[model samples]
Target: MIQLKAGQNIPLTGDVVRFGAKAEAALDVCALVVAENLTVFSSEDVVFYNQFATAGVVLAADEVTITLAEVRADAKAVLLVVSADPIAFPGGAGLGPVTATLSEGDTVTAEFAATPTAGETALICLEVYRRGAGWKLRAVGQGYVGGLAVLLAAHGVDVDDEPAQSDPPPRPAARSGQGVPAMTGPVSGEASTVAGAPLEVGHGVERLWMVFEDAARSAAALVSAREYAAERLDHELSLAVSDPATRNTPAAEEARRVAQQRNDELIATAEHRHQQDTEQLMRELADADQALPPALASWDSPAWDKPAVSSDGIRLGELYAIDRGPLRIPYCVPVPLNRPLWIDTESTRAVAPVVGALLARLLAAAPQRQALVDIIDLTGAFSGFTGLLAPVLNGPLITDHADISARLQAMVDAAELAELAHTSGAFPAPTEHRVLLAADFPHGYQTADAQRIGALIMRGDVIGLSTVIVGTNESDSADTTVATLSQSCRHLPTDGGTTLFDPWTGSAWQLDLDLLPQEPERQARFMRTR
Candidate 1:
């Protein structure tokens, strides 16, 4: 129940065709092709230097597969592809050279390649008959479209990539001594393309007598060799067709399965490496201890640049114009605890609420309590109490006295207590670093605003309680201010100087900068202004 078709002649441009209700049948090897017969080459029009008349046919489409790229390379050759239909791929998926569902007529100049990514391979070719959706295939003929590509890969072509000379390199004439050859000057290191897709090449010659002579000689040479080759090819194909023992050989099946296993391993390795790289990038950003210098506002500029905080609020750096175009768009909701940010020190972009809770519980329970209490200015000392916290340390957990984590623990323990008794007058309160910072700085703030707030903290007279002044501003008229406290006030050397002046306590204050290494930048920045 099959109809004969006078299909359109396939040109050198290549072509396509749709099979109508083809009986799902296996093909016998010895049959000659007719107008009723349909066949597909494993690689169509494969020109192998006058070696054979044409390439071998697969006869069925769904038995094989091809890997493809989303965007085909505009390489030096003709890259031909065929597909059945338009297919959407996830994450901009890349498809290989295989054809999808072919339309009624089989010639297509527009290849329907649904590739996932750029510069990567996709499966483009396939065996025609398969086990799934009943979509017809579009036959692919690569050589017909773009033809051959000749590259001088063996020579020192790569050296051409270096800096070009003032005078162009000498080129061998395509035809020497009174000749009109097709080629011109020397090859620029760049690939000299022969116009179309990536495909096989043909050396051109124009003479009927010579062409016939060459063809005859080639055919004669092939005929001379056919007796030996045909015997081997026939024997191989016969073993595949006739002897069940040979046809069902375990070696071939094992080889295929082993190849499949190796391919799977390779793909898995690639994917794992990609994931690891991404995780490493995230870790670098999350664990930046002493990375780029914190952006400092010089006194001479007299204008505000928001203090550069990392993706989180830890050590502030310089505010560069990095977050441009898209990053400028606001993310989700505003964080409520903007002021006490200096204490949290967790990255702003990380999953924070859980860490915040863990810190709170740890601060309340760790046995080293006294050192934690002294760091905060509950008695009205330092100026940045209302500032937020960002994570400065996420080192390994160690219990010994000399361990870095333990050392950090001591400093943090002291910092936490100071946070509790100082600015808010909420003494003896549960010490969650995040909660304490929130109480001190109860709102969202931009980086410059945080710096301004830091400056205001210096104005604390009553300090930590009352008007809650942060910097040296004297004009704030708070009725129940947090900045007016007198007990915790003290002054030390103005950064690099030996002068001691207490703007808040108004007395001779003695302090050693070497003991508070954490505030060195803060000291230098503010001292320079004075």
Candidate 2:
């Protein structure tokens, strides 16, 4: 059987298919007959435990059998859904490790682990939809904290609007003292659960961010569940051995043993759930990383294995977590960056190569003529990159204090001219984006130079100008301008010691530096503009 990850789809070969979902907890398997617009036509379209069968969709025990040939002509797809059976788990339980399968007779053709986080109670496991003259199945591991009703409502089916018999009671939460703590990082069924701003679609980067948000929520939920379970176990054990009168009696010993056994079972279940969630997330991360364009891909990503290509965003680095196995979430900012970038040399490794990788990304975003690069390296740290990108340089590399000040003043003056031209319509807007790379900062910068640096950092984005400065992470040093710049710009430590906060949840994720390849030939191939 072929295993599938979330958002993956495959074509089906047979006409008669059985969609089965099995979990450690009892599940109410159901199917929705959705039209082309993704809405159910009537109450008869929703086939659940109460309504066993409808048209070609049938709920038989743990599986939903569908005769594709017998389905309604207007129906575009059949959605396979599963929710925790309220009758079996009255006090609420997670739908853990839901193994969904597609079978033709006794042969399983495809499978997916539609695992939800700790708080989720319902999930849309799979979808068998029309693909021209045939059918295709998709692994959709979207979860719902609000249970079956919410899942149905997202598909335009309101159980409350239907007849009384169709309205299933809302799933119950764990009763008081049942030891199940309130769930953390509540994941939504239809959209992102990232707390702050609604994620913007397109640009490819937002899609990756959505996937990162999913991984974050799943990881946090697992941690929260594990901690809560352990605490609950401790409390239960304490209660079990509290009686001094029967402390040494056989009954007390049995109670303690039972408590410990129950705790172990809970922990075991939690571990299994975490393992499944992690595996699924790793698959997703790998898939997303592999699909990333050259601009967003890591230095070692297969995307760079091929010829150079351009994309919508620039890859800053990636988020690293030891507990998350091999999963690496690529971090990206949009093409026209909103702020300057400060590469902290104190905390990162191989500062020159890191700068090279970033410059390469900026170059890849636009054509050679449209990408203007200006390098200032008095320390000769970027000498290798200077030679590799000599063909695309706007001017000679500035290596002296006088040249450094001249370049900064020139950029600041150009920015003012560009803004005036834009407002007066006297000249066409600047067609090219300028990138400034200043290495070993504060070495040649004076008090007046800092003001010029600050001006460029503030208004450069408006005039197609960007700055990448290298310096220490000293936000409170003697140099007030340096300290303010340190605090203001989007900063990344060269060694990946510090963390970058996610816009959605404000979670701190360590930045994994994207170092340039060690081979000179490889570096040339990547750095030299195509």
Candidate 3:
């Protein structure tokens, strides 16, 4: 049998060959048929112990055998990799010191031990390939620190969609003098017992200790030598210093001065290197933080109110804003039932369709025929919501200036009556609510109508009478608060300044809104059933 060390190879003369191994943990054997260009055709071409459907490879416990019959003619070589895990190779955990190519018919056997400092987990254990009409076995002990997945990805296998797997942290760098003893001289040289044989005289050790003067002087020299060696070679060097009398000579004193100067230079170099490393680490940490998705810093804040479903169709959308992270802050505007929802359309043409959809959704979500809707489409942009509103529209669509005035006065009168009824406690608050949707307000409203409209906005919330005013102009009254929708799907209050509300993140984000689904038939059916 030929004993194969790492990076060794031998000729193969047979049609089939068997491999065997003994390991402390379970091992997986995989084979890849590589081409001249070094690219894999597909993930399916990789054969592992668990998936052995490849034509000529047979896998079993501790060994795998490859037959020559099924290897493709265009294949350059078969690479054999051994791993400890199924999903990923153990990075830094080494493998295999094996024997192979024992005579033509003999089986190959391999044994592997874990590394003292596992520098890699997955290793290219062997390679079987054609060598001019004959086969050859090569022991390739190259290891991958990133494991099998990384190795495969490097060769163009698409593993981007694979589930995230935890990777082993990189081995920490050894600190100065770790695991190494202070050496008085060369580690391989003969041992010496002379006290002052290893240290040079009179350079940085005059007062190394506070104890006995003679012993302290000797100890200081030794300490200086060790420090000098560690700074230069990254490990303490063993050296034999001569007697004190010998070291006190002129030549020794000069050598001591030179060593001290060199040691100082090394210290400066080390400090500079350390500063660079610290800066690099800080930058990497900052990049990692930026890559992570934003999250809430605290869930207990009052601004993070929970959202509630509105029975009336005035539920515009959820609000999203950014605080410590992206947060889903509730949109607290009470519409259709309480407050007037004024949507300013100057910034966005999409406001009309969005408002239409909101109205349709509210109508569809309402219980039975308890909610009423009236449309005054001054801009004639309510066609998107017309199918859903057709079944429940309170009156013929009002378009004239006089008609809008009359509608606002009627709502005011109704609200006053409802307020009187509510105060008297004659009956429970009415379940049926009226919604006035006045599209393109102020454009078709006279001064009298505007005053009436302002009054409705002021008292509509308390009386179960609400108005949705859609217009391009800003309202003059504080009671008529306005929310403007931008073309980018940013919802901005006229008074709220630059902050834009994102409905999806429930936070203030720069993201545009996703188009609301337009299901006219479903909405129409819902309105009819209600």
TM-score for each of the candidates: 0.17, 0.60, 0.35
Instruction: List where candidate 1 sits over 4 angstroms from the true fold.
Output: 1-248, 268-289, 292-530
Rank candidates, lDDT, best first: 2, 3, 1
lDDT of 2 at 256: 79
Runs in model 2 with CA error above 4 Å? Answer: 1-202, 300-302, 305-309, 347-349, 426-429, 495-508
- How does residue 120 of candidate 3 score in lDDT? 50
* lDDT tens digits, residue span 1-530, model 2: 87665544556888899988888887788999986445687889999988999998888876799999898876768989888744454444567788999998789988988667645678888889764467878776777766787678867786574321133322323323342222111121212223222223223565565456555544454454556668987887787678888778898778878877877786676556556656765776566567666777656668767765556567777776676445567766666554677887752235887898888888766553377788878777877767888777878988787888888888889888877777788757457778988777777777777788788877776566767888776567788877887666667765545444443233345667787776888888677565
Residue-level lDDT tens digits of model 1 in 307-366: 322111111111111211111110010111222222221222121222232222222222
Candidate 3: RMSD over Cα atoms? Answer: 28.7
Best by TM-score: 2
- Tell me the deviation in Å of residue 81 in model 2: 24
The lDDT, on a scale of 0 to 1, for candidate 3 is 0.46
lDDT of each: 0.24, 0.69, 0.46
Residue-level error in angstroms, candidate 2, position 88: 37
